[model samples]
Target: MPEILIAALSPVGHFGPLLNVARGLVDRGERVTVLSGAAHEREIRSVGATPATLPPQGDLDLDLLEPDSGREEISGIKRLNFDIVRLFVAPMPHQAKALAELLTQKRFDAILADYGFFGVLPFVLGERSARPPVLLFSTTPLMISSRDTAPAGLGLPPSTSTFGRLRNRALTLLSQKVLLRPAHKAANCQLHRFNSPELPTFLLDVGVLADRLIVPTVPEFDYPRSDLPANTRYVGMVHPSPTMRFRPPVWWQKLDGDRPVVHVTQGTVDNSDPRRLLQPTIEALADENVMVVATTGGPHVSELGFPIPHNAYVADYLPHDLLLPKVDVMVTNGGYGGVQRALSTGVPLVVAGNTEDKPEVAARVAWSGAGIDLRTGDPTAKAIRAAVREVLGDGRYLRRARELEAAYAQRDGVAEIAALIDEVIGERAVAP
Candidate 1:
C-alpha cells in the first residue's frame, strides 16, 4: 500500500471531508498522514491518521470561524480577490519548504491537497523526477465554463448569442489578469527557492502544476464544461466528518409527524446573525402550516436568545441526511455543502448571504431556478417569505433538485475517489 500525505487549511468544513477520504484510503491498507492547522489535529487524529503541524502564518488563526470577530474586514469582492492571492502566492514559500522537507525525510508516495494550496504545485512538479504523483482535491464546484456560459444546474435558458460568449471570455480574462497575476507571482517566488522557473500565468501555472484534479462535487450539481483539460474530474461529495456527528432529538420525531418540513440552517462560518436571518423566517411561516427546523450553529443560537416557536424546532446542528429527505425546502446561508446535500436529497433551497463563495453559489442556484437567492445586506422578511413561497409553490425547484439528485445517485463518490487514488499510486509503482 502507498503512503500519502494530505494538506488541508482553514475552517474544519473542508478538512472534514478530506479526512474521511483519507480514512477510506487507510481502510484499504494505505497509510495516510495529514498536515493541517493545529486546530484540526484532534479531528485528524480521530480518523486514525497522523497529523503534522503547519508553520504559523497570517490568518492561520482558527478563531476566524467565530462570527463577526473582525480579525480582517474587506468587501466581499475584495476579500475574494485577496484570498486568491493568499492561497496562490503569499503563503507558497512557507508551504513549499514544509512540504519539501516532508518529501525528503518521510518519502510520501503521493500528495493530496485542497485546491487552495496551489503553491504546493511547483514543489510537486519540480520533484517529478524523484517525487511521487500528486492529486488536487476541491470540495466545491469547479466552474469550467466562462462566466457568461449560463451556469450549470440552474434551469435558466442558455445564452446562445455570440456577444454572451464574448462577455464571459472577457470577464474570465479580466479576473485572471487583474486578480490572479500577483497571486501567481507570490506563488512562483515561493517555488523559486527550489530553483524552479517562473510561472507564465496563474491559470497556466496552476494547470501545469497539477497532475490530476478531483473535485468533490458531482457534475449534475454543476454544469459540465467542455472546455476543461483532460486532467480534471468531478468526484462525488465526501461524507461529513465523523467527529462532528448529529443525531435528531426524540422531539424531532413528533415535529415531523405530518406536515411538510423545511430545514433551515445558516451553517457555521456564515451564521453570524442567525436570529436576524432565522427569526424573520420563523415569523413568516409560523402558523404551523409547515414544520420549520432551524439551527443557529452554536454561537448564533446563543446570541439570539429568542424563544423558539411551537412549530419551529431550534438547535445547533442536524444530521443532514436524516433530515433532508423529510424536508421540502432548505433555507441556508448559501453554504456549498448544505446546498449540495439538500439537492442530493431532492429538496429545493432558499439561499441568502453573499459571504465567501455564497454569491457564486447563489448565482448558480438562481440560474438553475432550483431555488431563490436573497441578498444578505438587506434581506427582509418579505424577501425571505417570497423566496420560501416560490420554492414551495412553484414545484419547479423541487423537480429540478430531484432531477439532479437522480443523476448524482448513479455515482458513489467515496468509492470512486478512493479508486482513483489507488490507480495513481499503482501506475507510479509499476512505471519503472
Candidate 2:
C-alpha cells in the first residue's frame, strides 16, 4: 500500500470530509499522515491516520477570531476580505514551512490538501517534478471563477444569456482586480519568499492547476462551468463521517411523535452567536405546527443565553446521520457539507446564511429547487417562519430533494477519491 499525506485546516467543515477520505484510505491498508491543528489530534488518530500538528502560526483557534462579548461580528464583503487575509493568506508561510519540513523527513506517494490549506500551494506552484502529486479537494462551494456565474462571494446565480455572461465577466474582473487584489498580492509575497512562481490567475482558481481537483458533490448540485478544467472531478459527497458516534438525546424520541420535525443549525465554526440564525429560527417556529430541533453547533445549551421556547428542543450537538433522516426540513447557515448531507437524505432546506461561502451555498439550494434562500446573515423571525412554511407546504421542494437523493445513492465518494489518488500516484511513478 502507498503512503499518503493529508494536509487539512482545523475547522470541522473542512477537516471532517477529508477525515472521511483518510479513513477510507486507511481501511484499504494505506499509511496516512494528517497534518492539522492540535485540536483534531484525537479524531485524526481515531480515523487511523497519524496526526501531525501545524506549527504555532498555522495551528489557529477559529473561535478566538470572533468579536468580544457584546461586540457585533463583521459580515458581507468586509468579513470576506478579513477571512481571505487573516485566515487564508496570513498562514501561508507557516503552512508551507510545515509541509516542507515533513517532506524533508519522508517521501510520501502523494499529498491531499483541503481547499483552504494554502500551505500546499508552494508545492503546487513549484516545478511539478520537485514534489509528489498534490490532490486538492473542496468542502465548500466551488469557487473557481467562471463565465457562467458571478464571483463566488456575491451569491449570483448562473446565467447563460449574452448579457448575463457579460455581467459575470465584468464582476469577475472587478473582484479579481479591485476587491481581491490585496489577497492576490499577499499570496504572491509568500510565494516570492518560497521562490515559487506567483499564481497565474486568481487565488481560488489555483485549484484547477492541481493534479486532480476533487469536488465532494455531484455535478447537479454545483453550477456548471463550461470552462471547467479537465482535472476537476465531481466525486459524490464523501459522507457519513463513520467516526461520529451518536447517542440519542433524552428528547430524541419526540421526532417519532405527530408533529413534523424541522432542524436548525448555525453549523460548527460560526455558531458563536446564536442570534445570527439559531435564535431567530427558534422564535420563528415557536407557534408553528412543526417541532423545531435547534443545535448550538458546539456551545452549551445554556450558552444560547436565552429561554428555549415550548415548541423548540435544544442540543449542543447531534449527529446528522441519525437526526437528518427524521427531519422534514432543515434551516441552516448553508454550510456546504451540511447542505449536501440534507439533500442526500431528501430533506429540503431554508438557508439564511450570507457569510463565507454560505450565500453561494444558499443560491445553489434555491437554484436546485431544493430550498428557499432568505438572503441575509441575520434573518428576521418573520423571514424564517415564512421560508420554513414555504418549504414545508411546497411539494416541489421535496420532489427535487428526492431526485438529488437518488443521484447521491448512485456513487461512493470515498471509493472514487481513493481510486483517483492511486491513478495519480501510478502516473507519477511512470513519468520520465
Candidate 3:
C-alpha cells in the first residue's frame, strides 16, 4: 500500500476538505497522514487518518485567517492577501522542515496538498527524483490564470467581446503582479532557502507543476479555460462523508410549509459575527412570505440576542447535504464550498462577501446567473432583502442553477480523486 501525506495550509476552511480526501484514501485502503495546525488533530484522527502536527512557528497566526471584522472591503481584501501569505505562505520554511523530517522517517508514495499550503512547494519543485509526486487540491473555484476568466479577487464578470478579453488579460496581468506581489516574493524566498527554482508566478506555476490539480466544482460552473494544463482535473464536489449529526430543529417542519425556504449562513470560518449575514438575512426576510432558516455554524445560535422573525428557524448547524435540496435560495457570505453545495442542489444564491476569496465567488455567482452579488461582506438587511427577492422572483436564476445541478450529476469527485491518487502513486490499490 502506498502511504500518502496530505497537508492543508491552515486549519481553517482548508482542512475539512483535505480531511475528506484523507477519508477517501483510507476507504480505498491507503494509509493517509494529515499535517495541519495543532487545532485539527482530532478531526484528522476522526476521519481515520494519522495526524501530524504543524509545529508552532512564530511566523504564523492561523486565527488571522479570519479577520476580526472591521475594514473597508477593498482594504480588507488587500489585508487578507497579506495575511494569507503570513498565516499560510510565510511559514513554509518551518513546514518544509517538518515535512522533510517526516520524509526522513518514512517513505511516502505521494503528497496531497491544499492550494495555500506553500510548505510543500520546495519538495514539489525539488530536482530530486526521490521526491514523491504532489497533487494540489482546490476547495474553491479554480483561481488559475486563464483566457476565459478575469483575475480572481476582482470579481469582474467574464468578458467575451474582444475588448472584454483584452480587459481580462490586462487586469489579470496587473492584479497578478500588484496584488500578489508579497506572496510571489515570499514563495520565491522559500524556494531559495530550499535550493529549488523560484516560481515565476507563485500559484499559477504551482498549478502547472502539480502532478494533478483537482478542483471540487464541476467544469460547467467555472469560467472556461482552454489553456488549463493537462494535469488539471475538475472533480465535482468532493463532499465529506455525512455524519448526520445535525438534527433538524424543532421548527424543521417550517421547511415543509407553503413559503419558499431561504437558507442564510456565514459558514464556519468567518461567522464570528452573525450580523455579517444571518441577522441581516433574518431581518431582511422578517416580513417576507418566505421561511428563513439560519445556522450559526455551532452552539452560538443561542447567543443571538436579536429577535428572530416568526417565520424563521435558527439552529447551531444543519447538514447541507440534507438541508440544501429543500432550500429555494441560499443567502450566504459566499463561502465557495457552501456556494457549490447550494449550486449542486439547484438552490440559487444571494452572495454577500468580500474578504478572502469570497468576492471572486460572489462574482461567479452573478456571472453564472445563479444569483445576485451584494458585493460586500457587510451588507445591510435592505440590500439582502433586495437580492433575496431578486433570486426568488426570477425564474432565470432557478433555471441556471438547475442547469449547473444537471452538469454536476453523476460526478463522484472524491472517488475520482482517490483513484487519481492511485494513478499518481501507481499503487493500483482497489478499495477493499
Pick the lDDT winner: 2
Clashing pairs in 3: none
- Report the C-alpha lDDT of model 1 over 220-264, residue by residue, as the tens digit: 666545466587877777766433555558677865577778777
Which digits, one per residue and each the tens of the lDDT, describe model 3 over residues 69-125? 332334643675666666667788888888898899888888898877777888777
Alpha-carbon TM-score of each model against the true structure: 0.87, 0.96, 0.92
lDDT per prediction? 0.70, 0.89, 0.81
Misplaced by over 4 Å in model 3 are: 10-12, 58-60, 65-81, 427-432
- List the lowest-lDDT window of 10 residues for candidate 1: 151-160
Q: Flag regions of model 2 displaced more than 4 Å.
A: 60-64, 68-78, 242-245
Clashes (backbone N, CA, C under 3 Å), per candidate, total 4, 0, 0
lDDT at residue 255 of model 3 (Cα atoms): 86
In candidate 1, list every pair of residues with a backbone clash. 89-187, 154-367, 154-368, 155-368
Per-residue lDDT over 47-125 for candidate 2, one digit per residue giving the tens place of the 0 to 100 score: 8999988976875446446666212476545566676878888888999999999999988999999888898998998
lDDT of 1: 0.70
